[model samples]
Target: MSTAQATTTHDEIVATVTGIVAQELGVPAESLAPDADLRSVEGADSVKVLRMIAKVEREYDVELEDEQVFAVNSIDGVATVVLDTLAQDAA
Candidate 1:
């Protein structure tokens, strides 16, 4: 019965995801755009993408579906999934 999870906003999720993606890809967070595909970035690979997803899940305390995770190609998509997952839990 904790409302702690409700405080997160979509912008915050996108910002957090951008940071995680940047960290995993060994790139500067400022270099990433919200709609840019992380996989298309230099130095990115499947392993790194998975690591980013794992870190994102850990950060939000949610387990994302593999289908959704695999379909996500940008920070915006990841943030959408996280927000959806959190909203589902809230329901």
Candidate 2:
């Protein structure tokens, strides 16, 4: 992927993941920070978090391994996984 395209993809993945977390947790999108602990959010639980990850995977057409998915504890971590998965898919 071109450098520009990679940047765009990363931004889109971050934005989309932020939106997903906001929607699933009933929090405002603007309140989501890359370092925020998803578990600390109101209405968030393991099941909801898993569902959110599943939605993200489907949205990006990337499958995250169970170990990677379970290890993601922050928005930034999730973004990294998304980017890595996209890069792998492209390769």
Question: What is the per-residue lDDT of model 2 for residues 1-91, given as tens digits with 9 covering 90 to 100?
Answer: 4564355466677888999999998899999898788888889999999999999987777789999988888888898898997788777
Candidate 2 residue pairs that clash: none
Q: List runs of model 1 lying over 4 Å from the truth.
A: none
What would the per-residue lDDT of candidate 1 be over residues 9-88, giving only the tens digit for each residue?
A: 89999999998988888889999999998889999999889989999988889999999999989999999999999999
Query: Largest lDDT belongs to which candidate?
Result: 1
Residue pairs clashing, model 1: none
Off by over 4 Å in 2: 1-8
On a 0 to 1 TM-score scale, where does candidate 2 land against the true structure? 0.87
Per-model CA lDDT versus the true structure: 0.90, 0.85
